[model samples]
Target: MISINNLSYYIGDRPLYDDASLFIGPKDRIGLIGLNGTGKSTLLKMITGEDQPTAGEINMSNDTTIGFLNQDLLSYLTDDSILHVAMQAFAETMKIQKQIDEVLHEMETNYRDELVDKLAKLQERFETNDGYTMQAKAEEILEGIGFSTQDLQRPLKEFSGGWRMRVMLAKLLLEKPSLLMLDEPTNHLDLPSIQWLENYLQSYDGACIIVSHDRRFLNASINKIVEVSAYQLNMYAGNYDFYLEEKELRNEIQQNAFENQQQKIRQAERFVERFKAKASKAKQAQSRAKMLDKMERIEAVADEAAAVDFKFKFKVKSGRHVVKMENISKSYGDLNILSHANAHIERGDKIAFIGANGKGKSTALRIVAETESFQGTLQKGHNVTTAFYAQHQLEALNIQNEILEELKQAGSGKTDQELRGVLGCFLFTDDEVFKKIKVLSGGEKSRVALAKTLITESNFLMLDEPTNHLDMMSVSILVQALQQFEGTFLLVSHDRDFISKVANKIWWIEDHEIKEYPGTYEEWEWWYNREQEKKKSSPQPQNSEKKEKAKVAVEKPRHDDTQKQLEKEIAQLEGKIEALESEVTKLETELSKPEVFGDAAKMEKTTNRYQSKKAELETLNATWEQLVEKIG
Candidate 1:
């Protein structure tokens, strides 16, 4: 639907993108990925017209619409209910409904034929726009994105920034634009909400461009991967995992070609050097030099992945019981976060706290860190020094200090060289270590904070949403660091891939109590899905005698006259169904024709007819089944 041709954007002397061309199809699900500072989000802004490209052009059809969900929406707040905000997506439908209402009111006074016709037209238009079901649609999307039914009517300003982002997401999804653009959407979402978004995008009709660091989310939701590298947009025909494998193969092939080209260039240069001085081979040497000058050199492959040689180090080994809590009861006036919850963390135990938003995952993490007060019997094991890392910690960093200086204050007692090595693992190297924290972006600040957190010689770590604002490579590095650490840690994060790799236990809050699944995230996911399936498959309990009475009350008696009438009705419905089925088949055939399908009006008309006939056929079939059951 949209085409970006030779797109280029520059900041001062730095070119973020140069001659980056990409085509977004009508139904493409594109995952835009790259390392930090790669201009993925900038591309989205350029498409949305929020940012002007330095060169090249972006073109889209006149009818194309866009819905963008970005971090900026987190600050959007108003007194309107979330449901009202979401329903705002159907502005045209709402306007039409208002016109219909006005027309009906005028008809009540005048009672004229013209008014009746106007009302009929308005109603037809409203139905075509699905105006009657707009509220339901908004509610479903809002709930699916983690808003509870009770919270739907709450003012948007009452929710936190993250929850507010969810409301914006719901509104955008409800808008159903022709091209949907989301930048790091999963960063604010919880696990269940992320899964819901994944399923929704799988069935989404429009084209989508999602820029995210969540690998699992990308793999589940997108069919194509576009990598922004070396100021160019490289298209991959498959998902993130496929891109990895394909890129590796392409890199290998390119490396081999580059090596061969280098070898040939060396041989030509050597031949020229040796034969240029000789009379017999002078012309040949000149020809070989021209060939060497004209040959296009192949660029070497640039590997995106980074290897981290540094691991988290702690001075003390904690006791077997790292942390223990009993009968924890905490509440905020009307909101009960935890009540009589009991859980414990053992030495070397890696736990992931996961659930939907508005749950007490962060609260539980704070309780573990002893930063939040509660009525509970909590105990910290011997030598269990604690270090807590959170998004807010990014603000705690001294803006005047350089990146290396920030690490020095962490007090791990590591040398400057050791700290530099740690910073390198986090993607900072050479002169980057001397860059002041004030010049760093949010993602860079997050890396710095994370580095500081890890360098602390604490046996117990409490990390809340550590993966937020981190790129996939950084997440992988943190995963590796955590895996190699000897400390006991409890973390709250929505990144499933990160959790699956680092966590050995799963924790969630249920009924205002802490719940534990003593297995990896993958295992807990399987068990949880099975449990949900069982709940869906298991029928509601009913007293057999009462159920039979209720059935008899609703069912018609199979009298002789009724049976004859039902059989006759069934036969008539069968004939109608057969005739309608033939009509539907003919419509389908016409719809497939080039003349019919090529014209928009004709295609829409034919599709409407086909759907109308199909619905009629289904109704007849259902009636036929009911009649047959009555006769039996």
Candidate 2:
């Protein structure tokens, strides 16, 4: 649909892209992967023509349509309600509809021939475009991105920046152009909403180029990976996992080739050195020298590894019960945030606290961290040490201190060398570490907060939106470090992909109630779907004697043949239910155990099977109930 030819772009003195060319075809779903400040978003802007490249051109067919969702541009349109803003994607259809209405009115009043002709043409256009279904399409796109039906009517100005971006996403999806470009589309979405988006994008027919740090989303949604590295663009014809393996293989091959070339050059040089004055072999040595001179030297690509090695050194172990809360009720006037909530975190539990925005996730984190209080029994486990990193922890940095000093004060017990290494891992290397905290950008400050958090030797870590300002590479590094850490983690994150990778248990807070599901995020989703299906299929309880109305009247009871038959059927169903239940239980038990849940594929398969069995058991139980009632 679009072709980028010899595209080179720069920012000031930095070259973002060099001779980068890519072709986006129909049905091509691509994940644009890169490190922080590698110009992923800038490249998208150039592709969409919102930003011009420093050199080269982007060619597109005249009829091709493109929709680009820019995070920064969402604040421009604030007067309209969220629904009205999103519905603007159908403005052309709406205009055509209005024109058709005017023509019909004119024809009805005066029976003008021209009006009738125009009306017929307009009707044809509307039908051809499926203009009648525009509103439904818009609603579907909006709802899929987690916008509540009621939220559509609210003014866009009332919503926070995150929600405004969702409104933008809805509009972009509703437009359904030939090419769809999304930058961090899942940034504000909850787990359910992210899943919904994944399913939607998986089935999206048009071409899409998404710049997102959500690894699981990329692995599940994209068919290709486009990596921007070292002022060049590299294409891998598969998803993120495929890209990883392919990139590694390619690097290994290149390394081996480079090694072989270097060895050949060395041998040739040695021959030339040893036979410089030899009479018989002089010509051969000279030939070898010439060959060595002409040979093109191959250099191995630089090894890219996360600079920081995060190793948690705990000074004190947490008590058996890490944290305890009871009868917790928090409210803002009449709006109850949480009520009668009780929770306990053990010594070695990795808990993911999740919910939609403003559902008391942060509030709960604050309460547990003792930064805030509610009317409840909140107890810290004996010898419990806590290091809490709030979403806005970066704002608390000392402006006077440089990045290095700020990290030093965090007192992670690391030597100067180790502290510098940690700072380098966060991209604050060399003179960057000497920059004052106040001079740093928001993302840099966030990195500083992360570094400072790592310095604390607390057994229990409570991190709120730690990945918010991080780039894809930084986020991956953090995820890896957290996965390897031995300390307990209670994280509040909207990043579904991150949660899926790190969290063993999900504590879902919804509608002032919290439910704990012992599995990965995908498993939680499967279980939720099965529960919804059960609700939809379950029958309402019947009143007493309801079964008697359907029973056939019998003389002398006939040795209770109907009852015996029903009993036999019930027994058979019970047996099936027992077997299914056992399978589900076994899977759940395995998933609940920490060791088994670490294997991503195994965990997913086990969880999927568990969900299927649970659904089957529900069906069998319903059938058994029906049979028992019929027999009665």
Candidate 3:
């Protein structure tokens, strides 16, 4: 629906995109990806006509409607409820409805031809667009994004900045434009809200382009990745994971080709140098020299993986217990953020804290880190040390100083050389380290903050939105480092795949409640789905059928004999399965302990027996659940 030809844009002397041509077709779901300052958002602005390209032309179909959600702007209005602002997208339809009402009133008063004709046209248009269901559809979109029905009646000014953004998102979805553009849509969403958005985008018929740092969200919502690098746009098919693999494979191929060409050039130059002054071999020398001149030098492709390397080294050992929170309750005036929350953290535990934007995830983290005061018993284990990286902590940096100076200040005991080396790992190379921190972009500041955090010797790390501005490669490096680290972590992140890969347990906060689920994200999702289906299919009493049977002359059996027998069998099987699973968990935990590996033969025998039993129990449980679901 939109096309760009030979597009080129620049900020001052720095070129953002040059000779970049792209075509966005109908139903295209694209994930825009690039390094920091690579113009991903700038490109979006150009596409939406908010900014014009330095050169080249953009052609969009005249009939197509495009809706863009501005990441930096929030709707401001007086005396307008959140629902009223969101419903403004359908203002034309509402106007038509009002006109129809007036026409109907006029028709009742007088049999006028003009009013009758106008009413017919208005009714036809309304029915064509399914206007009668507009309010219901709008409500569904709002609720899916986590806005309560009661909150809809509250004024827009009552909602916070994040909630207002959700209101804008709901309005965009309700409009159902031909093309949709979203920048970091998951930034303000909780796990459930993100899941709802995934489902909505997956089923949406129009084209969409989203720029998000969340790998899991991109994988779930987008089918194609459009990467902006080296002042050009590169397209890749499939999701973010596929893009990563494909980009690496392509880089390897390019590196090999460049190496081969360089080898040939070196050989030619060697021959030329060897025979330069020989009279007999003068012609051969000159011929080789000319060949070298004609040879097309292959410029070495950039090492895509060298952007950043996060390697955390811990010098302090954590105690057996990392932290403990008892009866923690936080409130602001009349609103309670958290209520009677209790949690315990242990060494080497990678726990993810998940919740909505205002659901006290960050507040809990602050209380644990001792950065904020709370009314509760917050205990830190002996020998426990923490490195806290808050989202807005970078603002505390002295922007007037150079990046290297900022790092040196934050690094404490680290020497200048040590700090420079750390900065290099985060992509500050050569004289780039001397650049002023004030001139750095958002992503650069984030990287600098992270680099400083790495220099610390804390045994426990509290990272909030650490991957917010990081590219895919940077995120991978951080994830790898975290996976290899021995320290405990309490992370608040919206990246589902990152959490799935790193976290062993989830500390989910919802509805003023905190619960821990021991599993990967995929397993948690499976369990949640099972619970939802159970709730939806809970058995209801058949009162009408029971009444009819009560009036019968002959009395039937109290219950179905076959059903009772099946229920007894299923219960026994389930009990056995539950015991087997508990045993399996215990065995797995034991196997993971260092002491158990001292006896290799015994460990192997125990694992083998456990696996056999686990497989049998899994099959039996599956069969039992299938039978139960069928009968229930």
Give the winner by TM-score: 1
Question: Tens digit of lDDT per residue, candidate 1, span 474-535?
Answer: 89889988988888899999999899999999999999999999999999999999998796
Q: Which 10 residues in a row give candidate 2 its minimum summed lDDT?
A: 547-556
Candidate ranking under TM-score, highest first, comes to 1, 2, 3
What TM-score, computed on C-alpha atoms, does each candidate reach? 0.85, 0.79, 0.79
Clashes of each: 0, 1, 0
Clashing pairs for model 1 are none
- Candidate 2 contains a number of clashing pairs equal to 1
Best by lDDT: 1
RMSD of each: 8.3, 9.7, 13.4
**Worst lDDT 10-window in candidate 3:** 546-555
- Model 1 worst lDDT run, 10 consecutive residues: 540-549
Model 3, runs deviating above 4 Å: 75-78, 101-113, 271-291, 307-316, 332-337, 371-373, 540-632
**Model-by-model lDDT, in order?**
0.87, 0.80, 0.80
Q: Write the per-residue lDDT of candidate 3 for residues 132-249, one digit (tens) a residue.
A: 7567567657887899888888988887777888899999988878999998788767777898788778867689999888888899899999999888889999998999899898
Backbone clashes in model 3, listed as residue pairs:
none
